[model samples]
Target chain A: MIIRKIRGLFNHSVALVASLIMFIPVYLVVVNSLKTKVEASSMGAGLPTTLNWQNFAVVIERGKLLTAFGNSVLYAVGATLIGTTLAALAAYVLSRNRSRFNRFIYFFIIMGIAMPTNFVTLMKVMQLTHLINTQIGIILLYSATSIPFSVFLIYAFVGTLPRELDEAAIIDGCSPIRLFFSVIYPLLTPVLITAGVLNLLGIWNEFLLPLYYLNRSAYWPMTLAVYNFFGQFESDWSLVSADILLTILPVIIVYLFAQRFILSGMTAGSVKG
Target chain B: MKARTYPFYFAGGALALYLIFFVIPSIMGIFYAFTDWNSYSTEVNFIGLNNFRTIFSSGAGQNYLHFIRNTIIFTITTIFLKTAIALGLALLLTGGIKRLSYFHRVVMYLPAVLPILVVSLVFKSILNPATGLLNTFLRNIGLDFLAQRWLVDIHLALPSVIAVDTWRGVGYIMVILIAGLMAIPDEYYEAASIDGASGLDSFWHITIPLLMPVLTVTTVLNLLYGLKVFDIVFVLTNGGPGRATDTVYTAIFDEFSKGRYGMATTLSTLLFFIMIILGYFVIRLMHRETEG
Candidate 1:
């Protein structure tokens, strides 16, 4: 019993140390964002002697911070809406109606998860389609990338739902579209939210695709805004940290509210996807 | 359910977008790989195997094999470190330290939620050679010898990038693992203890075997993510200090930036083939698991 108690103490200490290590970066970002440039570059996680809003002020003014935020929201929400709706609709059909063609299509779509985005070819395709730097073009591309995984999630969820719901709706003289929009779609709310949030997180945080596709400053997403601003302010640690903090705040807020949904959604994606 | 054309309608929008954006480009990538397409060229002429040959012969100051080697090394190291640490964290959080598990979990997952670029940018400053927090902390503790030019040192640069990747990745893996650990019933552990099994003994005999499916999934996901790493490495080191940290994806990015479109497609085609092989096995494994 004594040995067990001692071992328990040892385990807790190790966990505490690990937790602190995990938090140091976050603490550095938050604290240093509020610090003076000298304090920030001094490379300590110390609290600011005085509250400093100048760094954030400078970042916001120079980085066009709000526009970037709007762009992130526009892209993430647009992609999620289109991707989730289309994926869910397909998943419903695939769930209710099974055919070799459907199965093949499902397999084909899910394969995108494993394939790296062929940007070299994608760039050419985008250029040819006149989607090189347009927000709508990026949204369409994001939706394309998101479909495979979202379809997988909704498909798995729809499998657990009984077929009788569709049968009942159809027997009530409901057209297929109305049956889907009224009965089946409402029933899929839980999984839809899951898929939506997951795709939102992914689309919002995605950097490489945006960096490749969106070359113009006017169309830069939040992630791109942060990257470019960081380059411009290479030596200004305070402003850089402040820009980063601003970029993550919205995500952090969303996470605090919907962590359970987000966590389970991600796990479900990996495990079953 | 009877056969209906409705299913096709439901899937058409997504299918069209994917075909236009993803599939056609992927197929074209193969054809383009054999062409001499570049920003400087007015006409894309067929140059069978030229790009591949040039890459093999090290035309871009970065040999194809060097990128592959660096990619494999980085992937394997990050996957190993992330999986092991995440497992450790899950074990620690689930075993006897249950009270603060929520706090620990939230804090651990905080970094995972941050954009990869944000995380990388913050760490670029944190790991700065001279006045960075890491070195400053080291010196303050009288361990100045430990400080090195993290992103600039050839030997240490790759490992530093790997560590950062592991930091961003481990928490997400740990959350999956904790859920997996939670699913195994308490009776198993209780039964093991009642049978005079030690903690380590139970962990080896009971915990590991039960966690195999989850572990397999985690490993495969890690392998895929590690194999395709780009954003973090790009933001952090930009494959710098003389190609010390260059991976296959970054090499492709550089080629694309340099207007060597055909060369970029060749590298991408190579990566695509590798992924296809990996993905085929992954699908097979999933099918087997589900069936059994």
Candidate 2:
């Protein structure tokens, strides 16, 4: 009993130390974001002598965060809706039919999960399509990039759903589109939500796409905006921290709420369970 | 009836978008790799083996091969580090300590959820050589000699980048591993114990064998993510301290920005083929798992 107790205590301390190591960076950001310029210069982990509530306001005004925030919302939401819906439709038919061609298409699309974006040639395609520096272009790109993983998740999910639902609707003389929208689509809620939330967060946190394509600040997402803000205010740790805080605040909130789905979704295909 | 119920056009939207944006560009990149496609001129000249030769030859200042070496090192190191640490955490949380395990898992996984840019930027501040938190704490603890330049030194830069990335990524791998660990039945261990098998023996016999599939999945995931790593290295070092940390992706970006489109496409094409070949095996493995 004494040995077991000692073992338990040792494990607990190890877990605690690990968690602290993980949380310290976030802790540092939270504390330094509220400090004065001089105190925040080093970006230390010390507590603030006084909480500067106005720092957020200062960052908002100077960082153009409002526009960036709106743009992020637009991109994340717009892309999630389009990407998830299209992926579901595609995954459903491919899973249901199981034809040689459909199977080939399914593999082809999901192969993108491992495929790296050839950005240099993608530039030419973007210009040819006249999407370079456009908000709509960014949305389409995010949606396209998201299709691979979304399709993979939703494809696996489509298998768990019985095919009887499809036959039943067909026997009722329902149109194909009607059967899908009215019956099959509604049953896909859980997977849709999982795919949607993951894509939302993924698109929200994305930096590379914007860095390569979106040159105009008017269409910059929070990630790009915060990066630019850091470049300008690199020395001002307080303000940079504030900018980063505001940028990630939404992502943290969403993750906390939808973490159940996010965690399950992330682990879905990797583990059999 | 089959065609009518599940119309082929339903898949058309995703197929079209993917082909146009994803596939076509990659195919075009293969062609562009052999040309002197640049922003300097409208006419793209065929420069057959020149770009490939440049990457292979390693001229006076060009370190294309070095960049590839750095990427391989980053990928291998991160995979080993993340897998080992994550496996330990998974075991600890699953069997070692039962209390507040969920809370601990959540806290650990927080960094993976945050933007890599944010994490790298914050790490930039923490890793500062002078008056930085790491150096300050080291000096305060009377270990001043232990404090060294974290990101500036060429030899230390890649390792520092790898360490920061490991910190951000281990939790994610741990979550997947926790699931894998939890799925193993308790009976296996109990049976082993009854047979007089020691703890280490059972772990080696039971847990390791059972967890092979998940381990393979996690390793492949890590491999893919590591090969394409850019954001962390970009924000932290930008392949800095004299290109000591430039990976393939960052090197591509550098070439692209320099208007050397031919070289950029060549490098991108190289990674593309490597990933596609690896991706082929990965998809086969994953597909088999789902099917079986």
Candidate 3:
């Protein structure tokens, strides 16, 4: 019994130590971002000696950080709307039918993961279409990419749903659009939220597509703006760290508020991702 | 008749868009890979195996093969370590180690929510040879021998970058494992205990086998991402320390930046084939295991 108790204590401490080690990188950024350049250069993991909030202020001022933040918010919200709606719509059709066409289409969408890296010709196509460098263009591209997983995921859940629900609404004199919005849409809210949260994070965190397509600094998304800040001051560790922390803070805050659906949605996607 | 056609109308708009934007582009990426399609040139010519030969032969892209090797190393090693740690931690968090599960989850998961660029910036500063937090602490405690130039040193850079990536990624794996564990019924462990099974025996016999499908899926996805890694490497080393950390994708990006469009597409195609083949097998193997 004594030996078991000793082993338990040892295991507890080991786990605790290991976890703390894992968390050091996170804690380091949070603490140092609050410090002045002098303090940041010193770069201790402890609290700032002077308790400076000016680091964030400096990053905000130098980077037009609010404009970038607002731009990202606008871009992410729009992209999420398109992605989730397209996904849900495609899912609805696939779920309601037992046709080979639907299955083939559904499977085809997952290939987006396989081959959709940066395509310069696609950029040229966008330019020729006169959609290049516009927020709408970026949103359209993002939504297109979001379809596969969305359809795949929503199809899995939507299949378990009863078709009679749609029929019941139809008997009550519902138009096709009304039937979707009123009857079926409400039923999809949980999965929609799952898909929405996933889309929201995905669109918000995406940097590559935006980097290629959106070149205007005034319209640059949050990631691009932060990356630009890093570029401008490649050797300035203090300013770079400060900007990095500021950029990640909003996402982390939003994530804390919606942690539940994020994990489950992400896990659900991972099993097939 | 209108109702019969309603479903087609509903799926038509999104399906058309998906096909045009996704399906067509994917096929086009492969076709372009075989041609000498430079963005600068007005007309492109066919370049058969020249681009591929460059990757394996000793020349401009020889380092990409090294990057491929590094990426493979990072992916395989990180998956093994992250899965082991996540599983053990998930076991502990599922009421075994007792209490503070919520607090621990939030702390561990904080990294995953942060963007990769931000994570890289944080680590780049944190891993500096002088006055960086990692080395400072190591030196303060009289463990100076362990300190090295982390991201800049050829010997230490790739491993150091992988370590940071693993740190950010473990929470994701742990959360998924926890979800997988939660789905398993509690009665199995109770029944096993009643059969005089040891804790280790019950874990190995009941818990591990049930978690196998999720684990397989997790490893596959993580490994694929690890192999095709671009963002973290782009922001962290950008194939620095004399191109020691160059992954094939990063090399492609450099080639693209240099206006070597045809060569870039060649590398991209190579990556596309490698990932697709590996990803297909892993997904099939996992799906089969889950169904069986």
Q: For this target, which candidate reaches the highest DockQ against the unseen true structure? A: 2
Give the per-residue lDDT of model 2 (tens digit) for B142-208: 9999898999998999999999999999999999999999999999999999999998998899999
Better of 1 and 3 by DockQ: 1
| Lowest-sum lDDT 10-residue window in model 2 chain B | B56-65
Lowest summed lDDT window (length 10), candidate 1 chain B: B1-10
How would you order the candidates by DockQ, starting with the best?
2, 1, 3
For candidate 1, the docking band is medium
Please give the CA lDDT of all the candidate structures. 0.85, 0.94, 0.76
Comparing 1 and 2 by TM-score, which wins? Answer: 2
TM-score of candidate 2 to 2 decimals: 0.99
What alpha-carbon RMSD in Å does predicted model 1 have with respect to the real structure?
1.8
**Residues B232-252 of candidate 3: C-alpha lDDT, one tens digit per residue:** 888889988888888777887
Which portions of model 3 miss their true places by more than 4 Å? A1-19, A114-116, A234-238, A270-273, B1-6, B59-61, B278-292
- Residue lDDT tens for model 3, A145-239: 77777776687778667878878878888877787787778888878888787777778787888887888888888899988897897666567
C-alpha root-mean-square deviation, candidate 3: 2.7
The Cα error of candidate 1 at residue A102, in Å, is: 0.9
The residue pairs that clash in candidate 3, if any, are none
